[model samples]
Target: MASTIVSSIGQGTGLNITEMVDALVSADTAAKKAQITRQTNNNTAMISGVGSLRSALTTFQDAMKKLNDSSAPSFNAYAATSANESVVKVTSGNSAVPGSYNIVVKQLATGSKVASQQFAGGSSSAITSGELTVSQGGKSYKIDVANGATLESVRDQINKELGVQGISANIVNGDGGSRLVLSSTTTGAGSDLSLSGIPELEIDGTQQMAGSGAGYITAKAQDAELTIDGLTVKSAKNTIENAVSGMKMELTGVSTQTNGVGNPTSVTVAQDNEGLKKSVQAFVDAYNALQTTITALTSTSKDENDNLVLGPLTNDPTTRSLVGDIRKVLSEVGSGDQLTTLSQLGINTTKEGTLEFNSTKFTAAMNDKKLGSEVQELFTGTNGLFERMNKAIDPYNATDGSLATRKANLDKVAKNLEDQQAALERRTESLTESLTKKYVAMDTMVAKLNAQANQIKSVFDAINAQAKGS
Candidate 1:
C-alpha cells in the first residue's frame, strides 16, 4: 500500500515490510488497551450494582417509616362497637381507652315544621306582598313576597332567603287549595320553625291576601336527650363526640317507651391486634428483601468449567460491612422490660440471615396480658427496633451518607477511566505515526541499494563485452 519505491523494498531486500509494521504496532499497544477496556467495564458494572443496592435500601426505609411513627396505624389503635346499632353507633380514635359503656336514648331532637292556610285561588293564586319574618335559635330572617306573586312563587322566595340558615319552604296542595309549608333543615330545640308578620296565614294555613299580622307556628324546637350510665346529657345535635374520651356516639332514634329511659346499649372499645400484626409482617418482608439483595450482590457461583464467577460487589468490603451492620441491628435487644427483642415476639432469623415469624408464638405474644403491652412498645417505642434501624439507616442514606459517598466515588472512577482511555488513544496514535516513518525510511534505503547494484552490474557487463571484442 506504499508508493512504487517503498513497495520495491520487499522485492529488493526480501523483507515483508507492511505486514511486519502492522504486527509490531498491534503488539506494542495491546496490553495497555486491554487494561483500559477491563477497568471501564468493571466500573460500569459496579455503578449498576450499587444503584440497585441503594434502591433496595430505600424500600426498607419506607417500611420502617410506618413502624416507627406513632401517628401511624398500629396495635395501639382503638375501635368502638355498639350493641344496638339501630339505636346508636360509635367510632373511636387512638386516644380512646379500652372499656365498655352503657348508653340510653331518651329522645331524638326534633325541628319545627309548620304549614300555612290554603290559597283560595289555588297554586297560581296571587297573594298580598309583605315581609315574612322567621325566628330560630334567636336568629331571624325575612322573606319578601311581592304583590301578585303566585302561591308556589311565594314558597320559593321563602326557601331562597332561609335555606342556608336551616330553613326550607314548600307548597302543599289539598282539598282546601295550595298551602305553604315551612320547616327547619336541622334537628334541635334551637332550630325551631316559626313565622310572623302574616296574620291570615297564622291560625289557619295561608294568610289572607287582604289582611296582615303574623304567620302560624304549629311546632316548636327541642333538644336531644340521652343518658350515659344514668347520667343525663343534652346536645343541640344528634351526634356527640368527646363525651367518652375518643369515642364518638351518634343518636339514631328516639326511645320507644318509658320516662326518657329504654334498654341500655353497650358500647365497647378495644385495641386492634390484627393491625399491629400486619405491620410487623411487612417489616419482616422488607428485611428479607434487603438480605436477599445483599447476598446476591456479594455471593459467588461456579461456572460449567468449575471456575469461580464473582458477583458484582465481591471485592467491595463496604457492602459486606453494611450487611453486617443490618444483621447486628436486627438482633439487638431493645430497652423494654417484658419484651425486649424481636425474638421475644416470635420473629426469628434463619441461618441464611433472613427473618421469619412464627404465627403461634406471635399470637401468644399478642395475647399475653403483660407481654402484649411490652411487645407493642418493642417496635414502636423511641428505642424500638424500627426506630433504631431507621436511625441507623438514615446516616447511610443521607445526602452525604455512605450510599451517597459510594456513588460519588464511583463517579470519580468513571471520570478517571475516561481520562486514561483518552491518554492511551493519543499514545497509540503517536506510536503508529513514529513506526510508519521508521518503516518507510527503511524501505527507501533498501530500494536505493537495489538501484545502485543494478547500475554497477550494467557497467561491468559493458566492459566484459569490450574485452571479448579486443
Candidate 2:
C-alpha cells in the first residue's frame, strides 16, 4: 500500500515531493553546516600554528645552548693543528696560549711480554695446584689452581681471571714442546710482569727479583719518550697531556734523523675565529627562522579575491609579546670593553624584524687583536648574550608554559568544534527524517482523494452511455 501511494504521489500533486523534501532539509541546515565548517578549519589551523611556533622556539633555544656551553664555550674555542699529522696530532683547549711548538716523536711506550719455560709434556702437562699471584703495572691479582690441573687449564684460568686486569696468557708450540706466554697491556718503565708461587711456569731472571723464579722477557716495558722545542719529555703512554698547558699531544711515529737529532713536527695553536663566526651565523639563522614563523603567525594578507585573510594567530597576544620580549633582550647592551651588543658583532635587526649578518664586519671585529679576546666575554659565561636570550624565551617555550597552555586551549576548542559538528549532523538527520515523513503522508492523502474522484467520474460516464444506447 505504501508503494502504491508512493507511485501515485506525483499523479495527484504534479510535484516531486522527494526532491522538495531534500531541498527543504538542505535549506534548513545550510547556515549551521557552513558555520561549523569555517570554525573547524580555524581551530585546526590554530592548533597547527601553535605547534609550528613551539618547534621554532625550540630550534632557537638549541642554537642558544650551542653558544652557551659551559665547557668549551664557542667564543673561547681554540684549534691545535700538527704540521706533520703522520708524526704527531695535537688538541688544544681555551687555556692554551697561541704559539708554535716544535714537536718530535722519539719513541712510543712499550708493554711487556714474557715466555715461560717449555714443558716436554706439552699443553696437557700436569701443574702444581697453588695460588698464583700475578703483578703488572702496579696492580696484582691471584688465581687458584685446582689439584690435577694441566698446563692448558692453568693457561685458561689465567686468561679468564687476569684478562680483565690487562694481562693474558697463551701457549706456544716450539721445538721445546708447549711454552706458556704471558703478556701485559700495561706500558711504562717498572711495569714488567712478575709472578710468585708458580715456579713450574716461571722462566729465569725475567724480573730479576732476588731468590724468585722468573720468566723469559720476550719484550721489556718502556716509557714513551719525546721532546717539545728540544726540551725532553717522558710519558707512560703515547698520548701526552701535562707537557703543555691546555694541550694534548699524541706521538704517532719516530722522527729521529740520521744526525742523532729528532726531526720536528710543527704544532700551531690559535683561536678559532672562523668556527665562532659559523656558530654565530647558525644562531642568527635560527633566530631568523623563528622570526619568520612569528611573522607568518601574526601577520595578515590578502586572498585571491582581495578579501583580507587573517593568520591563525593574528589576534594572539602571546605571540606578539613573545617576539617583543626577545627583541628587548637583543636590544640591551652588555659590559664589555670591545663589544657591548650583538650589533657590534655585525648582527643587526632589519626592517623585516629579522637579523642580518654582515660577514665582513664580523670578520674585521673578530680579527682585531684587542677585540678578539674580549668578544669571548660577551657570548660566554653567566652574563653572556646567549644566556640572556635563553632566559627571555624560557617563559614561553618551557613545558606547561604560555605556548603549551595556548596549544592545550586550542586543542580543547578543536574538540569542542568537533562535538558541535557531530551534534549538528544528528539534528540534520532528525529534521530530514521528520520532514520526509510529513511530506510522504501529505502526498499519500492527496493521492487517495484523486482516486475517489476518479471512481465517481467513471460511474457517471457509465450511466450516460446506457442512456445514449437506448
Candidate 3:
C-alpha cells in the first residue's frame, strides 16, 4: 500500500490519489515561485543601496579635494609707475669751438656700473672751452677739454666707441648757456645707471648724484587685506583666485599700479555649506536603510513552524561573503590631502552596521582652518582614502558589477522554479484524464451485474405460482 501511494504520487494514477498529489506538487511549485520573486526583490534593493552609497562617497571626496586646493597661497600683487624727467649734458673740448646749440637726446641707453665704465661716450664737442676725456670700454681718449668745445664735439667722440651703442648727449636751454643731461631708454629694476667724471651741473634743477645718472621711475603698492566668509586673508597679489576652490575674486580698485590709495578695495566671499550638509545627511539616511534591510533578511520570526521562505540565503556563505566584501569597501580610505579618516570626518559605523554622522563635530572641523586643511589632505593624495575606497567599490557599477552578478544568480533560480512548475502541470493533467476513464469503466460493469440479479428473481416467482394452482 505504501509502494502504491509512492507510485501514485510519483507517476500518473487512475484514481483521486493522483489528483491529490498533483495539488500538493502545484503548491510546492507555487512556494518556490514565490521564493524566487522575493529573492529578485532583494536583489533590486541591494543594487540600489550600493549605488546610493557610491554616490555619497563620491560627493564627500569632491568636497575634500576642493578644500585641499584652497589652502595653498598664490602670487598676484606687483605694479610699475613713472617718476621724474632727466636732462643731458655736453662740455667743452680743446680743438672744438664754443657755440650755444640745441641738443636732442636721440637714444637713451642705461647699463650696469661695470658695463657702463667699460664703454666710452661716442662723439664730443667743445662747450665753455673745457678739456674732457671720453671714456668707453675701459679705454679713455683725451680730447682737448676747453671752454670753446661745442656740444657736437662730445657727441662725435662717444659715438666712435663700439660698446656705447645706446647713449646720446644733447644740449637743451638752461641758466648757464645749455645744460648737459643723460637718460636711459629701458625701465625696470635692472635699468638704474651710474655715471662718473661729471661735476656740478644742474639738469631739471635737481642735483644729480656724483656717480648715479638719471633715476628711473618704479610702481609701488602694498599687500591686500580682506575677509572671506568671516575668515581673514592676507595676500601680496591683487587677485585671490585660489583662496577657495571653484571661487575667484577680483578687487575692483586694487592693483599692482594703483595711484590713489586709502583702502584699495574690498569683497565678500561665501560658500554654500547648507547644500553640502543636506547631501551628507542623505547619504547617512540611505546607509541606514540598507543596514536595516540586511538585518531583516537575515533574522528569524517568532513562529517556530513557519515556512523558511528565504531558505539558506539568509545565512548562506555566499551571501555573507558578498555582504562582507561590500562592508569592507565602504570602510576604506580616500586619496589626496585627506588627513582625516572616515570616522574623523563624522562617518562611523553603528552597532547595527549602519553609518552615523557627528554633525556638530564635523561642522566645527570645517570651520576650523587648520583642521580643515588636514582633513582635505587625507582625501587628495595618490594613495588617499577616497581613491582606495573608490577602487574597492568599483565592482558594484551598473553593468557587470558585483550587484549585477547577484541579480543574475537570482534570475537563474527563478527560471529553474518556473521549469519545475511546468513539468508538474503536465503530470497533473495526464493523471486527471486517466482517472476519469477508469471510473467510467467501473460504472458499466456494476450496471450489468444488477440486471442479471433482477432477471433470476423474476423466473423463481413464476415457477411458485404454477405449483400452487395445480
Distance (Å) between predicted and true CA of 382, model 2?
Answer: 3.4
Model 2, runs deviating above 4 Å: 1-11, 63-78, 110-222, 332-340, 398-405, 461-470
Scored by Cα lDDT, where does model 2 land? 0.80
Candidate 2's TM-score reads 0.76
- lDDT agreement with native, every candidate: 0.75, 0.80, 0.44
For candidate 1, which ten residues in a row score worst on lDDT? 204-213
Q: Cα RMSD (Å) per model?
A: 9.6, 5.2, 23.8
Q: Give candidate 3 regions above 4 Å deviation.
A: 1-246, 249-266, 270-282, 303-313, 329-338, 367-369, 374-386, 396-398, 468-470
- Could you tell me how far off, in angstroms, the CA of residue 41 lies in candidate 3 after the best superposition? 11
Ranking of predictions according to TM-score: 2, 1, 3
Model 2 over residues 196-237: C-alpha lDDT tens digits? 777786543245322222364544778888889988899888
Candidate 1 C-alpha lDDT tens digits along 85-186:
888889876568889988888887777776666676777877767886776667777778777777788778877877887778887666757667777767
How many angstroms is residue 252 displaced in model 2 relative to the true structure, after the best TM-score fit? 2.8
RMSD of 2: 5.2
**Of the candidates shown, which would achieve the greatest lDDT relative to the real structure?**
2
How many Å off is the CA of 303 in candidate 1?
A: 2.8
